[model samples]
Target: MSSDPFEIFLVATPGLEAPLAAEAAGLGFEPEIQPGGLTVHGHWPDIWRANLMLRGATRVLVRIGAFRAMHLAQLDKRARKFPWDQFLRPDVAVRVEATSRKSRVYHAGAITQRFERAISEELGAPIAADAPITIKIRIEDDLCTISLDTTGESLHKRGHKQAVAKAPMRETMAAMFLREMGFDGSQPVLDPMCGSGTFVIEAAEMAAGLVAGRARGFAFEQLAGFDVAALTPLRGAEPVTRPATQFFGSDRDAGAVRMSGENAMRAGVADWVRFETRSVADLQRPEGPAGIVIINPPYGARVGNKGPLYGLHAAMGQVLRDRFAGWRVGIVTSEGGLAKATGLPFQPAGPIVAHGGLKVRLWQTGPLGG
Candidate 1:
């Protein structure tokens, strides 16, 4: 924990690096995307803020140390020597994950075993693979680096949604979708194909001035000398009142509608949003002036069928065009053919962002006008 802004890494869905870096910069962090993730130069406070505010990031990592190790022994020795007292706690459980390339520690399992033993024996820390605290290791050629996952569960979990549909929305992707649409809290936001209500929940949270990290406990809290006290003000800050009808979500599936409503209640944003069950074709335009309409419909892979999705896209596009005049529209899909099937003119706006190994892009129309 040197005084200098520690090197932090933000792992995301590949093509999302640019947007994630832009998000980091917006949060006052200096971020640069490297190969696997974005590297940010900042202090612990900056790291905390990134974990709290970065909606597009999968994980926030603080680079504890990096070194060149020619062999397994060197890796173990360096691993043990890494001032574990600063990050590891004797009472807490931790997990070790490793990846390798041309390095001598070529076996990920072997690397995890050795590193796990080093921490347990040298630092007197316990090891638990399923634990909240995780130590991530990456070995590219001869370079080995170690980082700590400050955000235990993925930021997408948001501590809500005990139930979801077949293809629910990921919080990171949902946030990115909203960002692409330039969604600010000022106007009404809608998600007609709301699924489990992820987009509406995220929109409401943003509108209500809620910090994404406030509702959940982070893995970093269990680490040694974790300044939970320093975070008191953040946790105690007055929760934003649910804005009146600023956010709306609907799904055709009645079960999904019930689950979304429950999830919103758990997230304490029920008042900020309205949830209903309706087919995408029947989606009505918002009563207020033009606003943003975002949708993450089933991409065929998750729903086990794509035959009806084409019709869904067409109907959604028609609704956006005929009913929601003067509003912006955004849709996320991994299939370009289906996107084009919408029949509404749209331009692709993304690099191939990786999601579960499938590359997805956002399709957007210019201004929603006749």
Candidate 2:
């Protein structure tokens, strides 16, 4: 509501900050890369746009203000005087969360309770366990920073893909990986192990010029002075230009293939994407120009065995090498040995990203030799 610029933080998965920052920059924002995210200074509409368009961010948080509070009494006093009316509505239920590091206010629970009391008693807002609006408080070295989560649900939800395969990749991470592999939606993307069709669907959406958050709502809608009429133009559909090449996905399991197709359909990309049941050994390059081939193959952590995974990776490498000439390859796996077993001339492995409680890296290669 205020005309002043708010510090907008785009939360990224650990180890993937650079690409997310690049994404923000490409979208015409000057983003400063932080430890786990990127920060940009912008007005309220910028916060809304980030939540709606950024494919790599997990959530968008707007920094309201900060204060130095040495004790709980100071924290409580300052929180009571803080102008919560600018951002929050008294009619809306809110949730308060807190984290502390190297600060006197060590107990996060007590910090949460204090803020909850301040907002409820002073600002006349109700605190609820299942509130869609979240106020995040972080205390570090005696400095307390208040932020609001503008994104109600994680951006990866994307309001589609009701069906999922085992160990499915999040859509946010998939989009970042696609960007990391130099995909601009100009060429085809084929995922031989496309569980739930994340990569293919994301590529199709990007090619179709679809907004990532178009299908969902955000926490900012619940904020005070949120002009829905002013925000409606940002949500307008862009001209959809179908890509010249089709995005493709395949899996050995018939059920997985079926699920991927259904997910693609829900994503509104079924027309530009294709899903089929086929094994890696049976993979054949599509009859078109060379493109990117990315796969999140089964790793030791996912399948509980490293022995068989090596052969699987090797077979994948063999098929790609023998059939898909002039195509780049990207393989996401937690084990370096498994990536090496592929025998592809992989460039340096990408950042170690945290996925499903396991650390994984992207092993990529230049165009395969004929």
Look at candidate 2 and give me any clashing residue pairs: none
In terms of lDDT, model 1 sits at: 0.80
TM-score of each: 0.92, 0.97
lDDT of 2: 0.91
Tens-digit per-residue lDDT, 137-191, candidate 2: 9999999999999999899999888898888899999999999999998989999
The Cα error of candidate 2 at residue 299, in Å, is 0.4
What are the per-residue Cα lDDT tens digits for candidate 1 across 257-323? 8988998898778887888988877888878777778877678876678998888777778777888
Report the C-alpha displacement of residue 341, candidate 1, in angstroms: 2.3
Residue 4 Cα positional deviation in candidate 1, in Å, after optimal superposition: 2.8
User: Model 1 misses residue 278 by how many Å?
Assistant: 1.9
